[model samples]
Target: MDCCTPSAGRPSTPVAAPPPGSGDHRIEQVSVPAQTFAMGDAHGDGAPGDGEQPVHDVRVPAFTIDATSVTVADFRSFVTATGYRTDAEQYGWSAVFHLALTDPDQVIGQMQGTPWWLGVEGADWAHPGGPSDVAADDHPAVHVSWNDAQAYCAWAGRRLPSEAEWECAARAGLPSRRYPWGDELPAAGHALNIWQGSFPAVNTAADGFVTTAPVRTFQPNGYGLWQPVGNVWEWVADWFSPAYYAAAPVEDPQGPPDGTARVIRGGSYLCHDSYCNRYRNAARSSNTPDSSTGNTGFRTASRKS
Candidate 1:
């Protein structure tokens, strides 16, 4: 959950440059369109894991994303337009959600393995359940990293989403399907905002959300974008290496040259199936780019003007 961008809390943004190609702001920036798919399908039947195994073919071309993830008023307008200071508020504390202290007068064990995180201190991302909890300035800003999502995409001029353009905009064409608006899962009510009943304990907000869920709630996929897979896990400038996709490069394969972990892409809101199913769409994971969590978060990319 740590990438490389952690300066402390609140203070980011200052790279600006965008605006000129039709000003699609208000955080609904869609686009996509760059054809070609089938990147991996490790055969869990309809492919479930093995880092989305061998199923190659990428291509890529068109760009633009961020229909969601990066909220909290878009990082408080990039820290009121660039003062930048994240990396989980400078790593004073993070990894929260220890089940609000499983009762018994709140102690229920220190948790860490899966009591549902809980490392808390001052926590970060505007104190998500820490520093006495605050967030909801409009969710989606969970302990950011990858260098505070590249300083909020250089102050929203944009950049960050190149694990083949974040898995070709989270496989919104249904090449394999496990999620990304397919393969059923968002039941009970319909789509978006994960972690339903029986998680660290029980949520049962159904899909209305027991946490997060604001940046456009649910439903959008086929290019309209929004949530890509689940709630968070973006950050893909590329650095991970699970055999470097057997030497990558079917086309737009930029990843691995050196590595300590980076690539994250989709899967958040504590992606279930017991523990990290990677929210599908060619599931892949890696961390430590700087490590900041509570269900990681990031988004922003460009260069297709």
Candidate 2:
């Protein structure tokens, strides 16, 4: 509910990633060198409860991460070979943005605060909005839970990047800039696929999309990472804790040992300045690991060899 999806259930157990080498799940990756950097609201202006304050020093080791998020085609290959079922498919429903829905009958219920989200039956990565709304092959695979992403990584011989690694990668050599490109978005600019006009009501589609865009729609960051700041809220391999940074380890800080919800980074297409303005390098959100939504997806990473 924080960033993208409503909580489906409190799943206490973590799903094991499937065995490696079940499919040809390869992706183009870019390397990020080891470095120390400030890992918080560089401008000291972030949401209150979301906790992007007290800019802290953090260091990460060399690692390689996917240049783009895991697309529908990539997930399809994994499912085709492993016959794996996503959490959404297992639960028989997933959260969908109201504007993305084609059939109202597919909606079973809606969240309390965020009425824009509808719990639709038969909604999964394959059928994002509803049974009729087929996902594009190149679009980021939405409706995928954190567990689902981990399973994909298992089959692909990859893993989700830690929150530290994710933020570090998204920074892409622009330390203090809110966006990977620069400090501020140009007037009437289309840097990323985010809500253009008034959120949830009058979207001008000025950014070429009211929903998810294809990977690399905008220019790559300095490290050649694609769409690092916007498009979808990506799942990272870290538990959520607003106070984690206060006492976190400096070098290669993996998040807290345990948490009810996992951290999500890079606000999604639904993000806007009028409402959910979390589309920045340091901005963060979290949801239940089992929760899935239309605007949430993930990329994979590998430790440097």
lDDT per residue for candidate 1 within 46-95, as digits (tens), equals 22323556777878888887777778777877776666667556546655
Q: Output the TM-score of candidate 1.
A: 0.32
The lowest-lDDT stretch of 10 consecutive residues in candidate 1 is 1-10
Candidate 2 Cα deviation (angstroms), residue 152: 0.7
lDDT of each: 0.66, 0.85
User: What pairs collide in candidate 2?
Assistant: none
Model 1 residue runs over 4 Å out of place are: 1-37, 40-42, 45-56, 61-77, 82-124, 130-154, 159-164, 168-232, 235-264, 272-276, 279-281, 284-296
Model 2: CA > 4 A from native: 9-13, 16-22
Cα lDDT tens digits, model 2, 22-113, are 55757798999999988888876568677776688899999999999999999999888888999899888988888888768988888767
Lowest lDDT 10-residue stretch of candidate 2 = 3-12
Query: Model 1 Cα displacement at 95 (Å)?
Result: 14
TM-score of each: 0.32, 0.96
Candidate 2 TM-score, true structure as reference: 0.96
